[model samples]
Target: MTKTRLFHSNANGLIEHDHNRDGIDRRGFLKCMAWAGTGALCLIEGGVLKSFALGTRNASQVQSHEVAGRLTFVQISDSHMGFNKPANPDVIGTLKAAVDKINALPQRPEFILHTGDISHLSSPDEFDTVDQILTATHTPIFFVPGEHDVLNDDGKTFRERYAKNSKGAGWYSFDKNGVHFIGLVNVMNLKAGGLGTLGNEQLEWLRDDVKHLPSSTPIVVFAHIPLWTIYPEWGWGTEDSAQALSYVKRFGSVTVLNGHIHQTMQKVEGNVTFHTAFSTAFVQPAPGKADGPGPMKVPGDQLRSLLGITDVNYVQGRHALALVDASLA
Candidate 1:
């Protein structure tokens, strides 16, 4: 098997390729492991994907920082279901582990926000597989488009499958527990190594969308692409993101969540907090660490240890939110 690394992205997760020395790549082969702690293990075998989980815990054990009874939800980014690579043959199995991790949370999220790229190739089977696994959870799933999900038929399938009640081509807003949630689409027109864009039409709608809300309202904005600068040379940042952020600047509490980079990173600017999630799929080289960002093929034994998820808790009046990134490693 030969090990070749390919890098891909979607709304809330990053997809990278891992190759075996024999010159072959399996889309999804996985395994489960335990080392006396609460973490899951994923691996590949015979070019087939397999996985298992350990130390399942209750989600409620995690505390809530809500000061004024703030509404809370879980954000799950990129899960490239149909993906098969040398990294792990069982991409779906790992994704299931992620969902299991989420379902096992002590506090069930109000809903699940899937940043984008729910499937690997925009294929029916891939989407179906993701849906079947996520269905195990009782929470509702909201989604935005990632570049990979729209590659086929101009995202017709993606829009139909995930954008139920979403306004104007997958951009929409909702009110939950006195908080405002805005979902934007920026990966549709992405260029190779270029920033993600939010066209004039979407901008206009966004302005009108939040026009009636009071500035005191807390806001949560999610999309597949990062709203802030994160290695623009690799197309990790957004083009019209500034315009979008400008509209939300008046709000006292603004939390921006995105996926696409495949790693967990956080940045705070003024009252706005930006967070990116890790890929349940595989790992990637850090920014500028390699000639270009792609799936960083590591030794098979270390693969599961490097993957995990993020837990976010916030209180209404609190100035700082606490985010815990649990790496599979």
Candidate 2:
């Protein structure tokens, strides 16, 4: 087997080298996880997906030229504020880094979509901190709750703070630039190690919500868990998502965005594209890569290279959204 050198930082600001080890120590592991999650930029133009790395380019160098018939947005997920674990000791710092990148983008996104896990324990202070940090972007944000956000009282605090107008556990929809955006709630009533769920009431609301929209209209769905099954064994996928998705299959263009697994994975079926974003706070092992899903530690130098952001753009008269993913390295 090929050997790899692993390095760690010491209190004296010195680097210590170690031989190949099966796992990283707590400090090094948390540092690695910190580098794993960032925001993303995506653009859809002329029915094509155009993606770019966020940290690779100087945001100031990006000119704000108005492209006719184009709509651009940023997606940031799994901030996990208030998380103080070995996998990531400074969740707030990493999240701030992501915000700085967003504010630096040449063309400001119309809005930002934060998929879930805004807080680790659903604490008011954590939510407040997230809001304060996100304020730097000066952009509106759309959100859905992750399992972590609803830890107490079925998301009472989260709903009060972020989603007051949301219906039936905070599922809602809106129209923007001819695109219909649907936000769903699946973290409620989760089974033990089972998938996320969209109850009967939410499904009924979803069907009626789209009944009046023309099939030609583009549709975007955001949730905390993958609507399509993506590793049921680890509870990464939603349980009754098929019923929820059946309502949008007839649309000409459909895109589903989610957060929860803390990594990027993409799939396409019929007229829909499903994608999951990386976390801003930590990294999780790939499906079946570890005993189960949790924080993943890597070489200190390789940490930032593994985490980054997703960017998406949409152009008028196009049937597809352009998507680009970038790493901080």
Query: What is the lDDT for 147 in model 2?
Result: 85
In lDDT terms, how accurate is model 2? 0.73
For model 1 the TM-score comes to 0.78
For model 2, residues 78-180, the per-residue Cα lDDT tens digits are 8889888877787887788788767766567899999999999898899999999999989999899998999988999888888999998998999889999
Q: lDDT tens digits, residues 84-170, model 1?
A: 888667777778777777776655667888998788788888888888988997789888988778886888888899996777678
Error of 2 at 132 (Å): 0.5
Residue 286 lDDT in candidate 2: 76
Question: Local distance difference test, per candidate?
Answer: 0.68, 0.73
Residue 106 error for model 1, in Å? Answer: 1.8
TM-score of each: 0.78, 0.81
Query: Which candidate gets the maximum lDDT versus the true structure?
Result: 2
